[model samples]
Target: MYKSLLVTGVCAGLLAGPAFAQPYGYDDGNDRPEYARVIRTQPVYQSVRVDEPRQECWDEPVSYADPRYQNNVTAGGLIGAIAGGVIGNQFGGGAGRVAATALGAVVGANVGAGAAAANTPYVAHEGYEQRCRVVPNSHVEDRVIGYDVTYRYGGRSYTTRLPYDPGDHIAVDVDVQPRAY
Candidate 1:
């Protein structure tokens, strides 16, 4: 009887050993999976600035007058009048001298006026001046490209970087195991 009992115990141990070695929730059991919902999806980004420099050029005109012209007209008139008067005074005698003096003065005055008008100085000149100013041109550019995902699983919320956007829901795996003490 002791041999039969020992043989039965050994056979039972061998049969159960394979059963214990197999994973749980297999063979006769089924696994239930919990799925999470994608509550929201938002895009994340960083601001970047870019600058492009451009140069613009143009020409402007400037003008100026000669200073010598202003004084020359008056000086020429005075010199001409003095010369005319001296020449006229050298001719005539007596009563004729008096008449000649009057005529000379008149002639001198006329010559002076004519010379002044003829010598009147006026000149027009054209010149060009270059001017330039820098105008800063700027604009904003969007350099942000990313995504933030919010998911709900087992009555709890979780956030992570989702490479692809989960349409409506996400699948979450939950496993149960017996603890050894």
Candidate 2:
């Protein structure tokens, strides 16, 4: 009877001790909170540029001449002949005068032609000309890079940034036990 009583007491004590000891449950409580269901999500964006404006310019040469100076050689010769004829008339008499006149005319004509040809004047006109070409312009705009998530758990609302959208419910682990600090 004594032995049986001792064994019974030992068994009872073991059971009661375990029951009174802190219930073997979860939370060390210092652990971080887990993710809960997402309530609302909004996309985040950033702006960027894809193209730019640039200007390019260059020069071109153009040539032209005075219309009146077109036939310099011919005009000069004619004027020279007329002048020579008058001068010869004043210098010699009869046949001698005629010969002199003829020689003078030939010499004058040759001189005039040479002078006019050598002294032909040309003008160089400089003008400014401008032209413009527009390149099709474009730019890149900010696009959604990620999502801003609002989640609810433990009867509280929380916010976070995520690379992708989490829909509806997010998984969470609960702690039945909390540690005393």
Candidate 3:
């Protein structure tokens, strides 16, 4: 009986050795296979660009002009009117000169204003948003680093420098002002 008890005690101790560090059934060891160390790291180094979400703007007071239509409206109209009147003069003479010039000016102004209007903010709340995340690093150089960090402002995913560690907090960038673009 003594010999049997000793054997049972030794077996129990051997089984429980790991439990001393953790729980009875818990395994905190990194069970990654030896080959896992040679994990293939794709050189994509790609990461979700954590940028300010695409935002929509409404018709706001003219703070600045978009370079696209700026010249078209400001100088294009005046120049067009001048050209139109000169052409008008080609058709008529004497008083026709004044009349044609005025007509050309009106047309030019209208065209210029129309061109400017093209840049008018098409204001409609079509609820547009940007996709961003609170990233710790700029990009993934080797492996697809997992990220668990969440942002408060926008629901975006960001990779952290914490080496794929779980339960890490991250931040996002979302501060776009009118005419700042």
Separate clash counts for every candidate: 0, 2, 3
How far residue 3's Cα lies from its native spot in candidate 2, in Å, is: 18
Clashes of 1: 0
Candidate 2 on 1-181: residue-level lDDT in tens? 9999999999999989967775333345757545577889999998877677666565555555565455787788878887787787678799989988988888888887777767887554565556556665668899778999898876788888888888886656766645779
* Candidate 2: stretches off by over 4 Å: 1-35, 52-136, 172-180
User: What is the C-alpha lDDT profile of model 1 across 56-128, one tens digit per residue?
Assistant: 6678876666556545655655665666667766878787776776677667766775776576656757888
Q: Could you tell which candidate, 2 or 3, scores higher by lDDT?
A: 2
Q: How far is candidate 2 from the true structure (C-alpha RMSD, Å)?
A: 14.2
> Candidate 3 on 6-66: residue-level lDDT in tens?
9999999999997776522233455532110111222224455543444444443333344
Arranged by TM-score with the best first, the candidates are: 2, 1, 3
**Pairs with steric clashes in candidate 2:** 37-170, 46-142
Best by lDDT: 2
Q: Give candidate 1 misplaced runs (Cα > 4 Å).
A: 1-35, 55-142, 163-166, 169-181
State candidate 3's TM-score.
Answer: 0.26
- The TM-score values for the models, in the order shown, are 0.31, 0.33, 0.26
Worst 10 residues of 3 by lDDT: 33-42
| lDDT, residue 165, candidate 3 | 37
Q: Which order, best to worst by lDDT?
A: 2, 1, 3
